[model samples]
Target: MGSEQLFGSIPPNWEYKTLGKACAEGGGDIQTGPFGSQLHASDYVPVGIPSIMPQNIGDNRIIEDGIARVSLEDAQRLSRYRVRVGDIVYSRRGDVEKRALVRNHEDGWLCGTGCLRVRVGEKNVDSRYASYYLGHPNVREWIVRHAHGATMPNLNTSILAACPFLVPPLPEQRAIAHILGTLDDKIELNRKQNETLEAMARALFKAWFVDFEPVRAVGAQFIAPDIAPDSMDTRNPGAINRAPTHWPPHILDLFPDRLVDSELGEIPEGWEVVALGELVEAVKGRSYKSEELVESETALVTLKSFARGGGYRSDGLKPFAGTYKAEQVVHPGEVVIACTDVTQAAEVIGRPAIVRSSTRYRRLVASLDTLIVRPKDFRITKAFLYFLGGTEAFVSHTYAHTTGTTVLHLGRDAVPSFTFAKPPAQLVQKFDALAAPVLERIQATEQESETLAQLRDTLLPKLISGELRIKDAEAFLKGRGL
Candidate 1:
């Protein structure tokens, strides 16, 4: 489809005009602000004010979390750098094309040195339209081509002011923005809903299993003293002698009232914390030196093969030999943890996965970067261990213990010293059972999100290139009822 056909059937009367011609004469201004040298960690206070940086600027939106804060004193000193509503902020260096439109809530936001804030003239253009125009594929390509600096690319004020654009009528610009924004809104809602579901599942797991409240109640009921005012024998004398109601006092008293502190953190009663080495063997897989890695019917598991919540994805897999055997394999239910790359801390670091299927590797090797855990005792369930690894406690301790100057690595020797609480075998089994469904749902949601994201990505280029028209998009969306 042609641009006109896709944008609209009966085209809105729009003009092709340069951005410079559309803006107020001498109206556009691009300026840089103070360096980080002027900013101090002490000057930052949480919940005070939002500080905008290049990192905050995404493709067309801003990320607010972990945003730096400036004190009232610093804010007054950097008053000239304060961003107003409707202003467009661009990354001056590093990634020249990255930009974000200042929203209503960003009126009082302050920016850093690496960012260039653009305030448009109010003569002939709408800021919203200009933001969309700048974000268009053709406009971004122009910006990238003109960006300067050999080592780190950048867009200067002159380059930005001179950038070309298709100045569609203000109304049409608004309509396009509205359409894209609606999709973005829906995506955000899905993300938030998924987060809530994940949080609820985690909370339930903590309450029933990690906290041992359910098992504790059962233990109290089963192991009550034979002669006491509130003994189970007296209160429920009829059921006291039953097999199901009988439990050893030692088992009931396995867990204590309060948890003890270890190097890792506070753990549940009766649970013993040990180093990662104590639980499993750590080894790096062999490097496939051949340029062309062959694909076979047998699956070859790599670091990228294992997704965060989704089990294993074979779409990106390479070929392997038929001779590959089980000895050089990762079996179902084995725990795999990423040991290197602390920079991705809390991403998948220290996260464990129970191999749901068998995978083959070259040279009888597992991935060098992943540390596989083989549970020494049945007392600690693999599911329980996976959840434990997913926790902040595990990540923080693992990060602290990791050693390396260039790339942080989890030394095999250090794994055995890592400590954690050891809950009883029966309680662990109960926790494993409780966490199974929650984890399964998480995996399912992740897979669904992946599919949706792939659909969006595939449609993006076609939609932007005029290869696919709005009618086509409408028909596609209608077909899917999306």
Candidate 2:
């Protein structure tokens, strides 16, 4: 009969309004994604435009790193439910509280089945503010109450439209949104930067090791006929005249003149195929009792610490009060493999999360269920080793060695037995030189994002409820050098 008692009391200037009233007419504003019957599981493809489903809707963000997607044609067929930048989307059924704002990169992504989209069109309400408001504890309670179905709860368009929102003036609303959005924007930026850095490192790895791009460069030069009798440009591997602006002459110099065949495959003349265990070692985590856990500081990292099955989640850790061994303790830029698999369909058993360090917490110990993966020496950088943990060979090896029925467990003891092609020493050093800094930058960005997220979460409820004045928030931001 009445709106949920969110924020206790609304400011004198603010008023309550239904979500439907906050949207503009025509389309784009409020709608459910394509119905279940419209898009089948078979419609998903290995690569295409990201099809946003419930799994993609993370806490305050949409994570599609490992999400299922559909072909562009299918996305177009369901264009009416397409989500654009600035739109707010929610999980339509189970976990109805899950919500995420559509960012620029997510523009034109099809709003897949089991989701709801809300594009706030009201003059006074900020879209970001509305998105956050929808996730506010009070609004979540309202949605939970209205949500039907006992076995599997569900939400629909009618229910979402009827949801109430507490409104504020445009200026104040924008201020609240700006303060929070600043943090969200930085967090988003860090995520994108990490993705770029990882992509660059992966591409480089594949080029140098798998496809042997450098070898191709040298091979092309050797196989080509001499244009001008004898002397040729020695600096360029891919070209005879001169090297491309992007290709550094120093990297070209590292490529070997000849190639040789090995049991693993074709390798550079002097390179060898080595077991992965020889390059890096996995250190098992220490056990802790529930009674030993404290309510503060960094705790043991579980598989849940892996966001969307790959990304490291700094906030996902719980506090622990027990002591741990040096090997079990993880530091910044370290990778920990999940030894325990808890997914319903045995999804990510041996998945690894790059342990993130922050000023907000002390040491983070790996759980008994995780294995701290460390490079044997400077021969291989931690970044390179972390990337290796994601390679197909590593994943397949882990999946094959896994045991148990209901709860799958990767054989932590046999990590070293897994083998992979070893690159030349100079190439490995070159990779570390180029890739380590990118990884370091990623760790730094992740640390900043985590800190900003904590600040944003702390300020949210109070600021939106008008307990914290806008002027004070601006002063707070200024003090933080925002």
What is the per-residue lDDT of model 1 for residues 248-355, given as tens digits with 9 covering 90 to 100? 444445445555566545565556765555655554443454443555554444555544432344332445554433444666556676665535323444455555
> In candidate 2, what are the lDDT values of residues 127-232, reduced to their tens digit?
7888878877778888888899887779887787788877788888888888888878788877776775566566667666666666666766533222211112
Q: Measured by TM-score, how close is model 2 to the native structure? A: 0.81
Give residue 47's error in model 1 in angstroms. Answer: 3.9
The top-ranked prediction according to lDDT is: 2
Error of 2 at 191 (Å): 2.6
How much lDDT does each candidate structure score? 0.58, 0.75
Name the lDDT value of residue 259 in candidate 1: 52
Clash counts for all predictions: 19, 1
Which 10 successive residues of model 2 have the least lDDT summed?
Answer: 226-235
